[model samples]
Target: MALYDVLLALDPSPVVALNRAAAVAMRDGPEAGLALLEELAGARRLRDYHPYLLARADLLHRLGRLPEAAEAYRAALAAAGSEPERTHLRRRLAALAEAGHEV
Candidate 1:
């Protein structure tokens, strides 16, 4: 199948968007992936999705938007329903704080 067709087929799937955003980040740049995440956030589609918020936080961190990245990580932690996920988010948050970020 064509790339566009495959993407279209997975358009309704959040996992697809998340992975696609990651791919875009790798292929184009963090800015492009961030744009997609922002769009998803604005739509309130992935507000409670840990991976979505995590991806946003990582992108913000890469862009040097440390404050926003911290916020995103916290949000992801809050929405994380699994203990392991919470632990991971906490680790990420701690790393950011240790980096002198105002988390």
Candidate 2:
């Protein structure tokens, strides 16, 4: 944890932040991860990063923030260039919608 903190403070890269956020989520809870992702989203640094949005959306979905999750998934899909990634996002979106989510 201390190592992650040092790295985050020294580098502050989105990838580092994301890893730190994942660590926090595992150590703390989904809320912690969501908070970190929200901060990153506000910074607009991971707008074009598919994994970032997918992580945010997954966290939101798990937290029952379906509408926001759907939006995040859509954003991820829009930015996704690979067929596999787009298929995955579409599948998730479809699953959410099928589960009565407002996608």
**Runs with alpha carbons beyond 4 Å of true place in candidate 1:** 1-5, 13-15
Off by over 4 Å in 2: none
Residue 27, model 2: lDDT of: 84
Give lDDT per model, in order.
0.83, 0.87
Pairs that collide in candidate 2 are none
Residue 57 displacement in candidate 2 (angstroms)? 0.3
Error of 1 at 40 (Å): 1.4
**Which candidate has the highest TM-score of all?**
2
Report, for all candidates in order, the number of backbone clashes. 0, 0
Candidate 1 has which clashing residue pairs, if any? none
Model 2 Cα lDDT, one tens digit per residue, 1-103: 8899999999989888988887888788889998987788755677788888788888888888899999989988998989999999999999998999889
The 10 consecutive residues of candidate 1 with the worst lDDT sum are 1-10
